[model samples]
Target: MSAIEALYIFDEHNATILEHVYRGRPPTASVLLPLYLSHPSPQPSLIYLPNTHPPTLVYSIIQDRLLFLSPSSAESEPLLALEFLHRVADALEDFLGSPLLASKIESSYDVVAQLLSEMCDGGLVSNTEPNALRDVVEAPNWVKGLLGGVGLPSSSPSLNPSSQTPFSLPRPSLPRAPSAATANPVPWRRANVRHTSNELYVDIVETLSITLAPSGRPLSALAFGTVAFTAKVSGVPDLILQLNAPGGILNTISLPVFHPCVRLGRWKEKPGELSFVPPDGRFVLAGYEADLLGDDHLASFTSTSSTSKSLASLNLPATPAVSVSLGPTGADFEVRLSISPRFQNKPSASTASSSSRGGLGSRSASAFSATGTTAHPHIEEVKVHIPLPAAVRTIADLRTSRGDAQYAPGDTGIEWRVAAKDVAALLASHHGGSVSASATLRGSVVGEEEEDEETAPSVSLEAGSRWEYDEDEGGGYQTSSSVEPAQQRNGNGKGEAEAEQRSKRRVALNRVLMPSSATVSFSVKGWLASGIKVDALMVDAKRSKGLGAGVTPYKGVKYLTVSRKGVEARC
Candidate 1:
């Protein structure tokens, strides 16, 4: 803030006070403190500081760091006794980097100080006037301890705290988060599946099994429960399937068709025999044909590897999670399976570095993870946006109107940041692969009427995600089954629902984008159904899990999706 507009002695507490004129414009988040005390005494404050270029003030204690600011500045007006005391706290915080985030903040402060001192040859405040804020200063015993003997405090000999604890990883506490944003990095494990190629490649050694939601059924007027198949034994199954989508891979849901045969089973994974094999060392399903589905075939692959490792070795979700994945290999290829209907964590997940102003509350955070036979042969990414309901939004607005919730230059909506690598790694670790990519920049502030194009910038991994994949893709649609798979079969693509409630669960949509390879169907515990039909899709190798062909990535692009309400399709 520029300077206090006015200061006065408190008529009630006989203390000094300061008032600040912060934000006065719409589309801006502002903070107003009309009772800032200048006297070092505990009495109430009567000073004000108003509108200036998004002012930043570092709050510090006698010899300790306390808080930070975006554009920290020096005092432009006479320091009220209270204000002077606060300056100590602010300076200490500036020097020490209060509340301690990563060590980088202290370094940042040092850099900024060096520049200021070198450029302007300005004087750094040393001594302080008395009676300001009083013992409100950090305890002498905690001076050095507060900073764990690093940065500002460590450099200053006299100011260091006497009673300090040894340096160690501090337990996470709620107070450390920046006041302007939400902070909490959700814990997620890499989704280790059969497909390791986030690029492009398919398998033929294993029969391809396909499933859709709605299961030729219907959702209640209130929307049907999204059913998901969990896991399956990867081998030659009685039947194999592939999606025949033509609305362009980007527009897979626009078209829909019925699979020749496939039924649903709950936890019941029993088939007559090992139905098919990967003839070309590729992943395949029995009785399915490739040429009939058109050369639109994006990728073609075959598998020839054996499963010496089992799913039990990994400490992940439920066992056999679904109920598919049981088949005999023709040559050897990792099987690709997914859940039907799809199950998602309602709150989704959030990262530690997100804006806090307009974000959803803590109650709206969640995490989802799964593991399987292989680590990386394929990769998938899902994005779900849950906007605030009108009721909550209204309440938040009312609070803001009363000068509570914040937004704008300094303030913003609470944010949830998920690094691109996080999703990439989840796909990697499971397939026994590695994730590589170009770093991404943080999102920027927006205008209210901003179009999606301007608001959504393109993003991707610098290098492709890598895995030790030995699987291939399938061609055409279903090749093995003519009598259809089964009804209510156990979960394979879909894992077991929470033991408590297996019915009518409200969840988010799980969108799966294959690595540039359209042919490699990576096995997923819950991403699709068992009976989903497809009319036509322009499959490409770009989304493949292997470094095959046509491995493409798009920012904000609708890459892989399946909708069953009207038509069943996948991109």
Candidate 2:
């Protein structure tokens, strides 16, 4: 089996910024760049290069207009190589900060080399965990200047070298201490970690991707969920995370994958229970995929006794729904989006009076979080994405009851944004007691015949001897009596041609203007879709073998719900 031979970073113009060789002899950038670019625009993430002197596999990913490419000559696991490239990109971003620009890479070569060394060992994959990398990597002094430029705290602990890869910078002479790997055996976490203010945060983010039919029936629905943990606790701690869903856990979650630190035996005992000693700082604890269309919805589509299909449509979860229709003129379109907050709450007696006056009429905009707690989670970054057809020339009569919207001539579609406070208020005012923020996008398509016909009706003919009109048998005014039969036939033919053109234009506009689907993105802190809760984070005295006796750490937990490019609806 082949392994990653070399890694290359390029700018937007295909200029090589950095190249690191890992295993075998790899082709140079001059040979691979043109080969990869030859595939045409919007290239695939993975490609094969058989025409090269030696057949090579290329795995690439684009971030912030910077391209990360990895090439291998021997037969290698495609996914393994691709995953390594992704890890490199993520590690780079964590070290150099977001929007990994050409300038950042240029100035941070020392840090980049050190990180690549730690993440890969001679082309074989090594430690890529951000938290683990932090323990070994030293922070570059340039980061201090960069952080200052960004108006961040110079002493922020998160910015310390422990959060990501080690910077390849000179360090002062000091006595060496036992490393995390030698002392703890677990390579993901640092040893003897300590924090003044012990705190833990569990952020659950779910992205929704769904398609709905014209009749409001779901075609496919999926939710990708991730549990992100930021630990600031002291010493080694053992914790159990419990989660519950509307239905049984087995029926809801599928294809669940967890961090290496999690104890598989505990999860096997109780599916949603996570037991593990978390790494220092922040990391993804687990991830899972949820079939929003549950068993009940699936059962409704099949028949047990008869070989007949059920006349039922899958009702999607309370998500943003979009519908597109032709305007009265049939040469334009109207896109309407219906938004419903996934979080619902029951107002308590103490806050009922204030809640009612708070503009949350019947729906609860901010409610108790996903852990079945009283903490209210605020809705933020509510946006609806509607993809339009290429034929749309311009938009007109664009209106929204809440928020703002805009689109260009060749834009895929319009994007509508609603303020967090307004989304909460709208949700409260709705009948369902959930956040309700919908938008209406109206637009006109290109219609040349319609424009000409509109002008033709307004033009008046001159009254002359050659244009003497005749009265029809039913008292209606007809064409001029002196007009020749051939001229009249030509006139009728022109009218037919205009009508046919208008009908064809309308049909084209209708076909191209109808929106197929729309996606919703938003975030809610202190909330989770799976109703998961952190009951307690305990430092097992027997299992935990760090710190002195009589040590009590301040521990807290939080939950969050997010949908970024996950929720989609079609019509």
| Best candidate according to TM-score | 2
lDDT string for model 2 (275-330, tens) is: 89888878889988887766566564453532112112222223555545465545
lDDT of 1 by residue, 265-368 (tens): 31024221121212111111222221212232223112332222211111111110111111221111111222211121112222222222111111111222
- List runs of model 1 lying over 4 Å from the truth: 1-140, 146-383, 386-571
Model 2 lowest lDDT segment of ten: 307-316
lDDT of each: 0.24, 0.66
TM-score for candidate 2, residues paired by index = 0.75
TM-score of each: 0.16, 0.75
Model 2 segments more than 4 A misplaced: 97-99, 131-138, 142-183, 302-328, 341-377, 428-449, 452-512
lDDT for residue 390 in candidate 2, whole number 0-100: 66
Q: How much does candidate 1 score in TM-score?
A: 0.16
